[model samples]
Target chain A: MRSNTRKYRLMILLCIAVTFFVFILSISIGRYSIPFWTVLQTLTLQESVDTTIRSVIFEIRLPRIIAAMLVGAALSVSGAAFQGLFKNPLVSSYHLGVSSGAGFGAALAILLAAGTFAIQLYAFTFGALAVAASFGLSRLVKGSSTLTLVLAGMVVSSFFSALISILEYVSNPLETLPLIVFWLMGSFNAIRIPDLINITPIILVGIAGVMLIRWRINILSMGEDEAQALGIDLKRIIGILVFCCTLSTAASVCIAGVIGWVGLVIPHIGRMFVGPDFKKLIPMSAIIGANYLLLMDDIARTLTTGEIPIGILTSLVGTPFFAVLLWRNKVGWS
Target chain B: MTFETRGLSFGYAKDRTIFENIGFSVGKGEIFCILGPNGTGKTSLLRCLSGISMPLTGSVTIDGKDLHSLSRAEVAKRLGFMPQLHSSIFPYTALEVAVMGRSPHLGIAASPSERDYDLAWKNLELLGISSLAEKPYTRISGGERQMVLLSMLLTQQPDIMLLDEPTSHLDFGNQVRLLELLRRFSKKGFSVVFTTHFPSHAFQLSCTVALMNKGTFESVGPAETQLTEENLRRIYGVDLCVEYVSKANSRTCVPIIKNDDGRGVGAR
Candidate 1:
């Protein structure tokens, strides 16, 4: 047991180191590339690098890097918490209709030619609204079983998705339609330092709240009756957890425009390495998720002159890897 | 703890009451058994005592304090509930499941500490399932899972235990083993209340027995006095013979199964 603890600690430390390296690498390797030393010199307040290179590092690359990391960590942590709360490994952060709702919100904002702030606000509101609808509909059913919630989520998701399609269909193909398509595809290109500043507290507080109750997630996963018998106030804890998880997820979607696969796949990777104890898994997922998305964004931006949408990149990589993970983790989830 | 119920009634819906106006009490170091057939309110009554469900009509009190008035943690610290056989979705290790028994004692932000881990290990050892600590709970057999749950309850260190059909899924050997463990717990000054379909289990354990039918307990008293053949017949809706075993110094119940022609199966 002691050795197992040592190994997991070492693994977590190693993951943090790798995430830091990837963060630096992502900032250095973008288009209109700055040299690694120049990036570092600018970051460290050295005057050797040119003003243009310094501006690229500070103004553009820094915000994108930070956005990528935050979105990754936020989505993955939310996914981990949701999976534990629902007691199903198959659950994703998107299973509750947040992505589809946010997608529609972004499309509507684009059609109305709203600024970034309004777009984000609209996305966050509608994302939360979608989940509320799902939960409310589930309660109206007889038992409010897990299956009912999942089905309600599907209903709300498709409803919002259809709204997005209608918005895209009516808008002129030359202007708003293309903009909506690209935003729905997802990117971190539009992120500025102010965007990062605005999202940081929500993500941090959400993550902290989840980590504090990480142990209880284990009990909650044991089914409602058993958890209640163990003295957990089921209604209060679950309500708080859902709020925290959705807060982060909505904040991420508002900024990044509905990135997929990170929330669904990163937590599974964390579980594969750390086991299902949420105390360990939540942190592991956070660090690994940050690194995973940063790496994916690096490839998305650097692979070609025209930037690839991160959602496309994530699904391209995530689906196959998750299939492999499911195959290997036969006993764990199945 | 002195656990008692007064005129308690409960049901999922307003119009349907599973049990009604039932009352009983068990002092420290006593064993209380509720025996009834399927669809009776034995499980519901146990749930009420554990504070998992509120009694609609009356009240349950532990040590003269109303059970509903206590916080969930306080109730959990005093009363340990072992639910019927359930399968967990995640692959939590046996030790982890055992350690969860300490949750009631933890603050909202606190995880189990080293001392808590030691207590869990000690309880697992006491239950003779220490070797299964590292095994996944989902991977264990039904009987071993029950023992693991028992170990978890032991780690809880509650003054009273409420078990709902604990031995329903166990084999005969395991059933006997669990009964022996309950007797040991009684000797250690823990009050036990369990629901069971077996009249023989009520007979084997030296405790107060309650025979329940419909919505109320038909009789409640020492097993020797309460578990009459006539009561068993009415409760079970089958004619049964309650006989004394001289060598074992115990009583057993055997159902008189009727053959196709209405003759007793044993007689044929």
Candidate 2:
């Protein structure tokens, strides 16, 4: 019964509080457990804190947590925007073939390159290009044809995935193959401030663009013809949205590998709060998604002695959560 | 505002022609009915006049301006449209669906104004289903959905309205009720173009009737002049039966003439 602005504000407050709670828990729960007071001191760099606790918290946990939260927010927001654009609940931010495209890019990078930065760059560029190609091809075939777009996405995904496997078969098994496989599963580890610094602007700009056009996104969900009839140049709106979503999603994929279900699930979860209104759904998903991923990462690192791939842990957690949601609600594509 | 099409002909694709070299026009304050059977390019023609689709060989002008040249928002500002068989395709509420009609009035990145909500609510109230505004559009009855559609179009507040088979899905009572509403809309100098198969309904309500045969207009004129027994028999391929229904409080209509041998001519 509350107005949209009130509901939106309340959701934001809730997200902020939950995110703070998760941030505290994320720093405190690792193998080297610290007291709440010491964790606070370590965080605020209080004079009483030990050097080891402070170094461990700031150097190791903080960057990983930040990366997880950023990746989570990026994927989910991208997913939410994508689901709204296609008007299909099943589509994620990666539905435009970003994952396949990015994987192909990464494979080529590792195959040809010598180091970490080069590999990341390879995945980033190729992944983005792959998505761009898929979109360009879809545009060629899809003229007011939603079905054609879906079909074109499928064709592009299948083609790139094949290229990825082919690249996998030819690469050196000990070094490049494991890296590609691990990258495919996704990870969050050993990331310094530079990785964080690199993707921050892309994520921020993409999120801002989506938020600015959120109301127009609501009209876009009414199907393209209705949007056009209402004076929305659908091509223009869709063009910008695709760039925003694809950039965030590809950037997240660059850092996190292929963390599967955040994009697939975040928008659906956000809908439970606001009844599919994007003006509320997008922001809520971002906050919730950030917290959700950080929490999952906390569990992943804490439960195991050595680091488990974040992808493995997320799949282990996310699949069951998704199943419960689907069982409770009749999850139709529309 | 009046809308007139000067030789509007359209096609679905290069080889697939729906309309071939057609022309029609409507003046202000007139209930102009275009009567045609299914797939006689009725919907396509409606799209063409609404400026959603372009004509293949001719042009349609609205208030002396060419329809094809105007921006869609500009066209929408002056025109309201009701597409036949619009399944919501998502779980939008009747209110949400109706509010989308106001999109033409909003600038990019702008929320709808209070006047937009007021117009939608007023239209819903006029349609007598303001209480059902929060209901899911797909969950409503066929007739009720039809009324909701009309309410949405009315909310557009366009000086001209175009509908394809406006009364097709409603029951007899609501069908007549909506026809009456359309009559009133045209009477208020809001030019209205509607396509229907019911000749008698057109005869009772419309100021003009346009009968489409094959892909072109066979006849266009006042209903009494065009919708004759011979025309009905030829168009519908029925032996044209008309019945009179008695109404309340001492009212009677002329009895219909039946076939002398009681053998009605059956359509092959």
**Candidate 1, position B187, lDDT:** 96
lDDT: worst 10-residue window of model 1 chain A: A325-334
The stretch of ten residues in a row with the least summed lDDT in candidate 2 chain A is: A1-10
- After TM-score superposition, what is the CA distance of residue A195 in candidate 1 from its true location, in Å? 0.9
Query: How well does candidate 2 score on lDDT at residue B40?
Result: 86
lDDT of 2 by residue, B7-42 (tens): 777776767789877777778887788887677898
Off by over 4 Å in 2: A1-5, A37-48, A142-144, A332-334, B113-115, B241-268
Q: How well is each residue in A1-334 modelled by candidate 1, as lDDT tens digits?
A: 5215678889998988888777767777866766777767788999777888888888888888988998899999999998988888888888889988888888888889999998998888899899888878888997465567778989999999999989999998999998898888889988889998988888888888898999999998988778878888876787778778878888899899878888889988887788778888999999988999889889988899889999999999999998998778642653
TM-score of chain B of each: 0.94, 0.89
lDDT of 2 by residue, A112-212 (tens): 86476776777788778877777778788625455556667788888989999999999989988998898888888757777878877887888877877
